[model samples]
Target: MLKMLLLFLIGAAVSIDLIAGQACQPRSANPGRACKKACTHDAQCRGRLKTCQCDNVCGMSCFNPNLACNDPGPFPNGQISPERGYGQVIRYTCNVGYNLRFGNNRTCQSNKQWSGVQPRCDREYWHFFIILFYMGEDL
Candidate 1:
Protein backbone atom coordinates (compact mmCIF):
# COMPACT_ATOMS: atom_id res chain seq x y z
CA MET A 1 0.00 0.00 0.00
CA LEU A 2 2.78 2.43 0.88
CA LYS A 3 4.63 1.76 -2.38
CA MET A 4 1.51 2.26 -4.44
CA LEU A 5 0.72 5.53 -2.69
CA LEU A 6 4.23 6.78 -3.29
CA LEU A 7 3.96 5.97 -6.98
CA PHE A 8 0.72 7.86 -7.26
CA LEU A 9 2.18 10.94 -5.59
CA ILE A 10 5.13 10.99 -7.93
CA GLY A 11 2.95 10.61 -10.97
CA ALA A 12 0.77 13.46 -9.86
CA ALA A 13 3.74 15.77 -9.41
CA VAL A 14 5.08 15.63 -12.97
CA SER A 15 3.30 15.47 -16.33
CA ILE A 16 4.89 14.18 -19.53
CA ASP A 17 5.23 16.31 -22.66
CA LEU A 18 5.11 14.29 -25.89
CA ILE A 19 6.84 16.64 -28.29
CA ALA A 20 9.39 18.83 -26.51
CA GLY A 21 10.61 16.11 -24.17
CA GLN A 22 9.75 16.32 -20.45
CA ALA A 23 8.56 19.48 -18.77
CA CYS A 24 7.91 20.06 -15.08
CA GLN A 25 4.46 21.15 -13.96
CA PRO A 26 4.14 22.84 -10.61
CA ARG A 27 2.24 20.37 -8.45
CA SER A 28 0.21 22.93 -6.54
CA ALA A 29 -1.05 25.17 -9.35
CA ASN A 30 -3.22 28.19 -8.59
CA PRO A 31 -4.92 26.54 -5.67
CA GLY A 32 -7.85 28.10 -3.85
CA ARG A 33 -8.30 31.36 -5.82
CA ALA A 34 -9.40 31.39 -9.43
CA CYS A 35 -7.20 34.25 -10.67
CA LYS A 36 -9.10 37.05 -9.02
CA LYS A 37 -6.21 39.44 -9.71
CA ALA A 38 -3.19 39.70 -11.99
CA CYS A 39 -0.68 36.85 -12.13
CA THR A 40 2.97 37.94 -12.19
CA HIS A 41 4.73 34.66 -12.92
CA ASP A 42 4.48 31.04 -14.00
CA ALA A 43 3.70 29.76 -10.47
CA GLN A 44 0.53 31.84 -10.42
CA CYS A 45 -0.71 30.08 -13.58
CA ARG A 46 -2.07 26.56 -14.00
CA GLY A 47 -1.64 23.74 -16.55
CA ARG A 48 1.09 22.93 -19.09
CA LEU A 49 2.41 26.09 -20.76
CA LYS A 50 1.96 28.12 -17.56
CA THR A 51 1.78 31.61 -19.04
CA CYS A 52 0.73 34.67 -17.04
CA GLN A 53 -0.18 38.11 -18.29
CA CYS A 54 -2.32 40.94 -16.94
CA ASP A 55 -5.08 41.72 -19.41
CA ASN A 56 -7.04 44.95 -19.45
CA VAL A 57 -10.26 42.96 -19.78
CA CYS A 58 -9.56 39.80 -17.74
CA GLY A 59 -6.82 41.02 -15.41
CA MET A 60 -3.63 39.05 -14.86
CA SER A 61 -4.88 35.57 -15.70
CA CYS A 62 -4.28 32.39 -17.65
CA PHE A 63 -7.48 32.41 -19.71
CA ASN A 64 -6.08 29.23 -21.15
CA PRO A 65 -4.98 27.49 -17.97
CA ASN A 66 -2.70 25.57 -20.29
CA LEU A 67 -0.52 28.56 -21.13
CA ALA A 68 2.47 29.53 -23.28
CA CYS A 69 3.45 32.01 -26.01
CA ASN A 70 5.57 34.84 -24.74
CA ASP A 71 3.64 38.01 -24.06
CA PRO A 72 2.75 39.34 -27.49
CA GLY A 73 2.05 42.59 -25.69
CA PRO A 74 -0.39 45.22 -26.98
CA PHE A 75 -0.69 45.97 -30.67
CA PRO A 76 -0.51 49.30 -32.45
CA ASN A 77 -4.12 50.30 -31.94
CA GLY A 78 -5.73 47.10 -30.73
CA GLN A 79 -5.68 44.56 -27.90
CA ILE A 80 -5.64 40.76 -27.50
CA SER A 81 -8.16 39.24 -25.18
CA PRO A 82 -8.52 36.08 -22.98
CA GLU A 83 -4.76 35.96 -22.34
CA ARG A 84 -2.11 34.42 -24.60
CA GLY A 85 -1.64 30.71 -23.90
CA TYR A 86 -2.39 27.23 -25.16
CA GLY A 87 -6.02 26.21 -25.82
CA GLN A 88 -7.16 29.81 -25.51
CA VAL A 89 -9.03 31.38 -28.40
CA ILE A 90 -7.24 34.71 -28.81
CA ARG A 91 -9.43 37.53 -30.05
CA TYR A 92 -8.29 40.90 -31.39
CA THR A 93 -10.18 44.16 -31.36
CA CYS A 94 -9.34 47.69 -32.45
CA ASN A 95 -9.83 50.94 -30.61
CA VAL A 96 -12.78 53.21 -31.39
CA GLY A 97 -12.92 54.14 -35.10
CA TYR A 98 -10.10 51.72 -35.92
CA ASN A 99 -10.44 48.43 -37.84
CA LEU A 100 -8.65 45.14 -38.28
CA ARG A 101 -7.18 44.89 -41.75
CA PHE A 102 -7.15 41.13 -42.25
CA GLY A 103 -5.81 39.15 -39.31
CA ASN A 104 -8.35 37.14 -37.37
CA ASN A 105 -8.61 35.39 -34.03
CA ARG A 106 -6.40 32.31 -33.71
CA THR A 107 -5.61 29.80 -31.00
CA CYS A 108 -2.52 29.93 -28.88
CA GLN A 109 -0.97 26.65 -29.97
CA SER A 110 0.66 23.96 -27.79
CA ASN A 111 4.13 24.94 -28.95
CA LYS A 112 3.92 27.99 -26.67
CA GLN A 113 3.09 30.50 -29.41
CA TRP A 114 0.29 31.93 -31.54
CA SER A 115 -0.52 29.97 -34.72
CA GLY A 116 -0.41 32.74 -37.35
CA VAL A 117 0.25 36.39 -38.08
CA GLN A 118 -1.05 38.53 -35.29
CA PRO A 119 -3.54 41.12 -36.60
CA ARG A 120 -3.07 44.85 -36.65
CA CYS A 121 -5.41 47.75 -35.92
CA ASP A 122 -5.71 50.39 -38.60
CA ARG A 123 -8.08 53.19 -39.55
CA GLU A 124 -9.58 51.68 -42.65
CA TYR A 125 -12.34 53.39 -44.62
CA TRP A 126 -14.36 50.18 -44.91
CA HIS A 127 -14.75 49.97 -41.13
CA PHE A 128 -16.79 53.16 -41.11
CA PHE A 129 -19.08 51.71 -43.74
CA ILE A 130 -19.67 48.60 -41.66
CA ILE A 131 -20.36 50.65 -38.56
CA LEU A 132 -22.71 52.94 -40.39
CA PHE A 133 -24.67 49.96 -41.68
CA TYR A 134 -25.00 48.55 -38.19
CA MET A 135 -26.17 51.96 -36.94
CA GLY A 136 -29.15 51.77 -39.37
CA GLU A 137 -27.47 53.71 -42.14
CA ASP A 138 -28.76 52.60 -45.54
CA LEU A 139 -25.69 53.63 -47.56
Candidate 2:
Protein backbone atom coordinates (compact mmCIF):
# COMPACT_ATOMS: atom_id res chain seq x y z
CA MET A 1 0.00 0.00 0.00
CA LEU A 2 2.83 2.42 0.79
CA LYS A 3 4.53 1.77 -2.56
CA MET A 4 1.31 2.30 -4.49
CA LEU A 5 0.69 5.67 -2.79
CA LEU A 6 4.23 6.88 -3.57
CA LEU A 7 3.89 5.91 -7.22
CA PHE A 8 0.58 7.76 -7.57
CA LEU A 9 2.09 10.91 -6.05
CA ILE A 10 5.04 10.80 -8.43
CA GLY A 11 2.74 10.43 -11.44
CA ALA A 12 0.72 13.44 -10.41
CA ALA A 13 3.82 15.61 -10.04
CA VAL A 14 5.11 14.62 -13.50
CA SER A 15 1.76 15.40 -15.08
CA ILE A 16 1.71 18.87 -13.53
CA ASP A 17 5.23 19.61 -14.75
CA LEU A 18 4.37 18.57 -18.29
CA ILE A 19 1.35 20.90 -18.37
CA ALA A 20 3.37 23.82 -17.03
CA GLY A 21 6.14 23.30 -19.57
CA GLN A 22 3.71 23.30 -22.46
CA ALA A 23 2.17 26.57 -21.33
CA CYS A 24 5.54 28.29 -21.25
CA GLN A 25 6.66 27.05 -24.65
CA PRO A 26 6.19 29.32 -27.71
CA ARG A 27 4.04 28.25 -30.63
CA SER A 28 5.76 26.93 -33.77
CA ALA A 29 4.43 29.80 -35.92
CA ASN A 30 5.97 32.37 -33.60
CA PRO A 31 9.62 31.25 -33.55
CA GLY A 32 10.49 34.33 -31.47
CA ARG A 33 10.24 34.68 -27.70
CA ALA A 34 7.02 33.63 -26.03
CA CYS A 35 4.47 36.44 -25.67
CA LYS A 36 2.51 37.15 -22.51
CA LYS A 37 -0.25 34.83 -23.75
CA ALA A 38 -2.15 33.61 -26.79
CA CYS A 39 -3.98 36.20 -28.93
CA THR A 40 -7.15 35.97 -30.99
CA HIS A 41 -6.88 39.03 -33.30
CA ASP A 42 -4.22 41.07 -35.07
CA ALA A 43 -4.95 43.99 -32.75
CA GLN A 44 -3.60 41.88 -29.90
CA CYS A 45 -0.44 41.06 -31.88
CA ARG A 46 1.24 44.17 -33.22
CA GLY A 47 4.55 46.02 -32.76
CA ARG A 48 8.21 44.98 -32.85
CA LEU A 49 7.63 42.13 -30.38
CA LYS A 50 4.66 40.98 -32.50
CA THR A 51 2.94 38.82 -29.92
CA CYS A 52 -0.35 38.90 -27.99
CA GLN A 53 -2.45 36.94 -25.52
CA CYS A 54 -6.11 36.55 -26.42
CA ASP A 55 -7.63 33.02 -26.34
CA ASN A 56 -5.22 31.41 -23.84
CA VAL A 57 -3.51 29.27 -26.50
CA CYS A 58 -0.14 30.47 -27.74
CA GLY A 59 -0.93 32.42 -30.92
CA MET A 60 0.16 35.49 -32.92
CA SER A 61 -0.06 38.97 -31.43
CA CYS A 62 -2.28 41.52 -33.16
CA PHE A 63 -1.90 45.29 -33.45
CA ASN A 64 -3.85 46.91 -30.64
CA PRO A 65 -4.10 50.70 -31.10
CA ASN A 66 -5.51 50.99 -27.59
CA LEU A 67 -2.83 48.79 -25.98
CA ALA A 68 0.32 49.76 -27.91
CA CYS A 69 -0.35 53.11 -29.49
CA ASN A 70 1.99 54.84 -31.99
CA ASP A 71 2.21 57.74 -34.39
CA PRO A 72 -0.02 57.54 -37.42
CA GLY A 73 2.09 55.69 -40.03
CA PRO A 74 4.63 58.31 -41.15
CA PHE A 75 4.72 61.79 -42.64
CA PRO A 76 6.71 63.12 -45.60
CA ASN A 77 9.89 65.02 -44.93
CA GLY A 78 10.59 67.21 -47.96
CA GLN A 79 10.01 64.66 -50.77
CA ILE A 80 10.66 61.48 -48.72
CA SER A 81 8.08 59.06 -47.46
CA PRO A 82 7.98 58.42 -43.72
CA GLU A 83 6.15 55.14 -44.32
CA ARG A 84 7.42 52.16 -42.30
CA GLY A 85 8.74 49.25 -44.39
CA TYR A 86 11.82 47.88 -46.12
CA GLY A 87 13.82 50.32 -48.31
CA GLN A 88 11.77 53.21 -46.94
CA VAL A 89 13.24 56.04 -44.91
CA ILE A 90 12.05 59.19 -43.17
CA ARG A 91 13.68 62.61 -43.38
CA TYR A 92 13.11 65.57 -41.09
CA THR A 93 13.85 69.25 -41.22
CA CYS A 94 13.23 72.14 -38.88
CA ASN A 95 11.27 75.28 -39.68
CA VAL A 96 13.15 78.40 -40.81
CA GLY A 97 14.15 79.28 -37.25
CA TYR A 98 14.82 75.74 -36.04
CA ASN A 99 17.49 73.15 -36.80
CA LEU A 100 17.62 69.36 -36.57
CA ARG A 101 19.40 68.18 -33.44
CA PHE A 102 19.84 64.62 -34.73
CA GLY A 103 20.48 63.11 -38.12
CA ASN A 104 18.14 64.57 -40.71
CA ASN A 105 17.45 61.13 -42.20
CA ARG A 106 16.54 57.72 -40.75
CA THR A 107 16.22 54.44 -42.61
CA CYS A 108 14.22 51.26 -42.20
CA GLN A 109 16.41 48.27 -41.38
CA SER A 110 16.05 44.84 -42.99
CA ASN A 111 13.53 44.00 -40.31
CA LYS A 112 10.46 46.24 -40.48
CA GLN A 113 11.54 49.24 -38.48
CA TRP A 114 10.54 52.64 -37.08
CA SER A 115 12.37 55.43 -35.31
CA GLY A 116 13.65 54.01 -32.04
CA VAL A 117 13.46 57.55 -30.70
CA GLN A 118 11.71 60.62 -32.01
CA PRO A 119 14.16 63.22 -33.37
CA ARG A 120 13.93 66.79 -32.22
CA CYS A 121 13.65 69.95 -34.32
CA ASP A 122 15.67 72.61 -32.53
CA ARG A 123 15.19 76.36 -32.93
CA GLU A 124 17.99 78.12 -34.81
CA TYR A 125 18.41 81.59 -33.39
CA TRP A 126 20.61 82.71 -36.31
CA HIS A 127 17.87 81.80 -38.76
CA PHE A 128 15.52 84.06 -36.88
CA PHE A 129 17.02 86.93 -38.92
CA ILE A 130 15.99 85.17 -42.12
CA ILE A 131 12.43 84.76 -40.92
CA LEU A 132 12.32 88.39 -39.79
CA PHE A 133 13.61 89.51 -43.18
CA TYR A 134 10.87 87.54 -44.93
CA MET A 135 8.26 88.99 -42.62
CA GLY A 136 9.63 92.54 -43.13
CA GLU A 137 9.89 93.07 -39.38
CA ASP A 138 12.56 94.60 -37.13
CA LEU A 139 13.80 93.55 -33.65
Candidate 3:
Protein backbone atom coordinates (compact mmCIF):
# COMPACT_ATOMS: atom_id res chain seq x y z
CA MET A 1 0.00 0.00 0.00
CA LEU A 2 2.82 2.39 0.86
CA LYS A 3 4.58 1.75 -2.45
CA MET A 4 1.38 2.24 -4.40
CA LEU A 5 0.66 5.53 -2.66
CA LEU A 6 4.20 6.80 -3.32
CA LEU A 7 3.89 5.84 -6.97
CA PHE A 8 0.60 7.71 -7.22
CA LEU A 9 2.17 10.83 -5.74
CA ILE A 10 5.07 10.72 -8.18
CA GLY A 11 2.68 10.11 -11.06
CA ALA A 12 0.56 13.08 -10.09
CA ALA A 13 3.58 15.36 -9.94
CA VAL A 14 4.81 14.15 -13.29
CA SER A 15 1.39 14.71 -14.83
CA ILE A 16 1.24 18.24 -13.48
CA ASP A 17 4.72 19.08 -14.71
CA LEU A 18 3.97 17.66 -18.13
CA ILE A 19 0.77 19.67 -18.41
CA ALA A 20 2.42 22.89 -17.32
CA GLY A 21 5.38 22.31 -19.62
CA GLN A 22 3.12 21.97 -22.63
CA ALA A 23 1.34 25.23 -21.90
CA CYS A 24 2.53 28.71 -22.94
CA GLN A 25 4.45 29.59 -19.83
CA PRO A 26 5.04 33.35 -19.87
CA ARG A 27 8.65 34.47 -19.72
CA SER A 28 8.92 37.97 -18.27
CA ALA A 29 12.63 38.13 -17.46
CA ASN A 30 13.80 38.34 -21.03
CA PRO A 31 12.08 41.08 -23.04
CA GLY A 32 14.47 40.73 -26.01
CA ARG A 33 13.28 37.31 -27.07
CA ALA A 34 12.94 37.62 -30.81
CA CYS A 35 9.83 35.85 -31.91
CA LYS A 36 7.83 36.26 -35.08
CA LYS A 37 4.78 37.28 -33.15
CA ALA A 38 6.37 39.72 -30.75
CA CYS A 39 4.53 41.98 -28.32
CA THR A 40 1.22 40.57 -29.36
CA HIS A 41 -1.72 40.79 -27.02
CA ASP A 42 -5.32 41.98 -27.04
CA ALA A 43 -4.14 45.24 -25.50
CA GLN A 44 -0.82 45.52 -27.38
CA CYS A 45 -2.33 44.90 -30.75
CA ARG A 46 -3.20 48.31 -32.12
CA GLY A 47 -6.07 49.59 -34.24
CA ARG A 48 -8.07 46.41 -33.68
CA LEU A 49 -6.37 44.97 -36.76
CA LYS A 50 -3.84 42.67 -35.06
CA THR A 51 -4.45 39.79 -32.66
CA CYS A 52 -2.84 38.97 -29.35
CA GLN A 53 -1.83 35.34 -29.55
CA CYS A 54 0.69 33.33 -27.49
CA ASP A 55 1.93 30.80 -30.00
CA ASN A 56 5.29 32.56 -30.17
CA VAL A 57 8.19 31.52 -27.97
CA CYS A 58 8.55 35.05 -26.62
CA GLY A 59 5.15 34.76 -24.93
CA MET A 60 2.07 36.68 -26.01
CA SER A 61 2.73 38.90 -29.03
CA CYS A 62 0.88 40.92 -31.63
CA PHE A 63 0.24 39.56 -35.09
CA ASN A 64 -2.29 39.64 -37.84
CA PRO A 65 -5.47 37.82 -36.91
CA ASN A 66 -5.43 34.21 -37.95
CA LEU A 67 -8.07 32.59 -40.07
CA ALA A 68 -9.10 30.37 -37.18
CA CYS A 69 -10.56 32.37 -34.32
CA ASN A 70 -9.94 31.40 -30.74
CA ASP A 71 -12.73 30.21 -28.48
CA PRO A 72 -14.38 33.00 -26.50
CA GLY A 73 -14.26 30.86 -23.35
CA PRO A 74 -17.18 30.39 -20.92
CA PHE A 75 -20.54 32.07 -20.61
CA PRO A 76 -22.39 32.63 -17.37
CA ASN A 77 -25.67 30.84 -18.13
CA GLY A 78 -25.42 30.15 -21.82
CA GLN A 79 -23.61 27.95 -24.29
CA ILE A 80 -21.49 29.26 -27.16
CA SER A 81 -20.97 27.52 -30.46
CA PRO A 82 -18.18 24.94 -30.55
CA GLU A 83 -16.96 25.91 -33.99
CA ARG A 84 -14.30 28.63 -34.02
CA GLY A 85 -12.85 29.86 -37.28
CA TYR A 86 -12.94 32.70 -39.77
CA GLY A 87 -16.28 33.22 -41.49
CA GLN A 88 -17.88 30.65 -39.24
CA VAL A 89 -21.20 31.70 -37.77
CA ILE A 90 -21.49 30.96 -34.05
CA ARG A 91 -24.75 30.72 -32.14
CA TYR A 92 -25.47 31.76 -28.57
CA THR A 93 -28.20 29.83 -26.83
CA CYS A 94 -29.44 30.23 -23.29
CA ASN A 95 -30.29 27.32 -21.06
CA VAL A 96 -33.87 26.26 -20.43
CA GLY A 97 -36.05 28.68 -18.45
CA TYR A 98 -33.66 31.48 -19.44
CA ASN A 99 -34.12 34.17 -22.02
CA LEU A 100 -31.44 35.07 -24.57
CA ARG A 101 -31.14 38.82 -24.62
CA PHE A 102 -29.38 40.55 -27.54
CA GLY A 103 -27.69 39.00 -30.55
CA ASN A 104 -28.20 35.33 -31.18
CA ASN A 105 -25.59 34.80 -33.87
CA ARG A 106 -22.18 36.33 -34.52
CA THR A 107 -19.78 35.83 -37.36
CA CYS A 108 -16.13 35.33 -36.70
CA GLN A 109 -14.80 38.52 -38.24
CA SER A 110 -11.35 39.37 -39.64
CA ASN A 111 -10.61 41.20 -36.45
CA LYS A 112 -10.07 39.18 -33.29
CA GLN A 113 -13.35 40.29 -31.74
CA TRP A 114 -16.58 38.59 -32.68
CA SER A 115 -18.97 40.57 -34.84
CA GLY A 116 -21.65 42.51 -32.94
CA VAL A 117 -22.49 41.98 -29.30
CA GLN A 118 -22.81 38.72 -27.49
CA PRO A 119 -26.06 37.68 -25.82
CA ARG A 120 -26.85 37.83 -22.16
CA CYS A 121 -28.47 34.70 -20.78
CA ASP A 122 -30.99 36.20 -18.41
CA ARG A 123 -33.17 34.16 -16.11
CA GLU A 124 -36.86 34.05 -16.98
CA TYR A 125 -37.84 35.27 -13.53
CA TRP A 126 -35.21 38.01 -13.39
CA HIS A 127 -37.41 40.62 -15.05
CA PHE A 128 -40.45 39.97 -12.87
CA PHE A 129 -39.52 42.43 -10.12
CA ILE A 130 -38.54 45.20 -12.54
CA ILE A 131 -41.76 44.79 -14.53
CA LEU A 132 -43.85 44.88 -11.36
CA PHE A 133 -42.07 48.04 -10.15
CA TYR A 134 -42.73 49.73 -13.45
CA MET A 135 -46.41 48.75 -13.48
CA GLY A 136 -47.51 52.38 -12.95
CA GLU A 137 -45.81 53.46 -16.20
CA ASP A 138 -47.03 52.51 -19.69
CA LEU A 139 -44.33 49.87 -20.15
Most accurate candidate by lDDT: 3
lDDT of 2 by residue, 1-139 (tens): 9999998877543322131243223334653334343444345544764533221222333333234223324332323334555324576666555556656666543223343455666655777687778799654
- Candidate 3 stretches with Cα past 4 Å from truth are 1-66, 126-139
Model 3 lDDT tens row, 9-84:
7754332213125434453456433444444236666756666554322455555545676677677888988877
My TM-score estimates for the predictions, one after another, are 0.40, 0.32, 0.42
- Report how far off residue 3 is in candidate 3 (Å): 89
In terms of TM-score, the best-performing candidate is 3
Which of 1 and 2 is the better model by TM-score?
1
Badly placed stretches (over 4 Å) of model 1 are 1-65, 125-139
For model 2, the superposed segments whose C-alpha errors exceed 4 Å read: 1-80, 115-117, 127-139
Ordering by TM-score? 3, 1, 2
Tens digits of per-residue lDDT, candidate 1, 1-139, equal: 9999998999665543333344435423433223333454557767665555433223344445544667766688888776665556778889887888667686655445565677888787887688788999555
Model 2, C-alpha of 93: deviation from truth (Å): 1.5
Model 2 clash tally, residue pairs:
14
lDDT of 3 at 23: 38
Count backbone clashes in candidate 1: 2
